[model samples]
Target: MSKIKLRPKSPVRLVATLTFLLISLQIASIIGQYLAHQFSIHRAIDVVERRISLDSAFLDVGNETLNTPANRYAIERYLERLEKVLEEKNLPVVVSEIQGVRTKSDLTEFPRLHRTTFENAEQTISISINSRNPLNEVGISWLSIILALLISPLFAFTSKKRRAQSAREEIVLPPKPRLVINLQEKTISNGIDDKVVTLQNKPLCFYTALVKYCIDNPNESLPPHKDVPHELMALANKCFGRLIELGHTKRKRPDFNANLDKTLSEIRAALDDVFTGYIDEKETYYPPRAQGEGSRSKQHSYALPSIKEDDIEIIGN
Candidate 1:
């Protein structure tokens, strides 16, 4: 405790720290000088602005009028208006003096018109505020803010109405149309004719009205079916020319004709079932094979395939 001693700081660290502190101080001084220079320039600009005003004095417009309190009041008002009018111009307008207090007269190159007047005071002045009125298509400039004020209400009313009417409305639905369908015949154009081929100046559907008519009058000496590949092919060709006629795109079942003939035979047999007189009853009971007194046997039913008129033979019967 009695021999406690303090160690000296390193010279290298002390020198480095001093160098950093000096550099920081120099940088701060430079920044301060730059800020001062900016401040001085801003002050100079302010002084220059103080020298001139943005508004202008009124000018004379009329020559035959007199100077009165009313006329003076008009001049002051004209100056205020001129100040407003000057705002729109690139080169600012500074009114000098209002002269010729009388009727509003024309002035050159300025929105306001004025003339020297004589009626009351030793010096009388008159001015005409620009009537930036829309005369036909031409417009006259004005210095007054009354128009701007008046239009604000119209804008506010429109805005409020627009806001109020912005709500969305639900759509109303209508009744559905009636629909009809047929299997044997097609009444609609979309049911057939995949290639949209027309026949007889109309689109040909396999089950369409024209096909039904053909079937109704098959013996009417029209196109035949055997030469054509399919049943619907002849119908399609009848509707549109052969060049544009759409064909039947179908996978004909294996031995389709044989199967169809077999089906037709079965149907013909069924129809011929009513022609039982063709068979002899005594021979139909059974053949002479395995004859017995108490014998049982199946009935031998027979029928013939249907024959068209062309296939029929003119016999003695």
Candidate 2:
């Protein structure tokens, strides 16, 4: 029987997995803290309820005694003692309102945590705690820390496995195709193959001017708009003059500046014919296409970007 083998994960997949795990753990931690705080609030309310129920003297007091100002002050003092007890236990609760006895003016400013009422034939007492999510009341347990520590080693092991797999499956690509611009023949060729693309006088001059400009200014892209730069136009005119001197074209000097976009499209179409079915070579030799529909801004150079100046051999110029 053959042993089963699992494919190694990519770096992107590993990173995504780590990110998801971290986010999940953070959400779980927040939920746990919230639940712990809620439990503390309920526990504090229960303590208050038990103390009020156990106060026989207050419960047995007549309606007349409960209505008196002195009795009401004593009840407020007893409630303050209960607040101290809760604070000592790290609950941090506040007695905000008592129905028919006293009401806090700023009760609406604080969130209401709990409310309860105690009633008998003699009188009724209502209490409310208006403090919520007290600081330092909820804590992360040691168990959660231990769980995180135990899970970290698993993530490390998975990350190492992915890296090792990527190393094992690494691919080596062939060298980039070279471009050769022959000015004398007015031809462009991919040096890897015998395939050559011949161009007319004006198109050849425009293409060669752009290529030479790219070589000189390797870091800059041509303007995205229809307007050509003065330097590029000058370079194109110089190439056209050279072609005319070489007797390649009998026609007079053509306007290189007029209809510049149409000339760029013609140059790109010629390059496309030569590098057809070869996507990488086409990308290397072809002029940068427009980015989007009606978009004037160019993100890439108007000339060959992938081909380096060292790789391009310009002859007869």
lDDT of each: 0.32, 0.68
What is candidate 1's TM-score against the reference? Answer: 0.17
Error of 2 at 3 (Å): 12
Candidate 2 residue lDDT tens string, 104-148: 334443465577888655566677776664444445555555565
- Clash tally for model 2: 0
Global lDDT of model 1: 0.32
lDDT of 1 by residue, 226-258 (tens): 222354345433433322322332322222223
* Poorly placed runs, candidate 2 (over 4 Å): 1-176, 224-226, 295-306
The TM-score obtained by model 2 is 0.42
Question: Candidate 2: global Cα-lDDT?
Answer: 0.68
- Rate residue 202 of model 2 by lDDT: 84
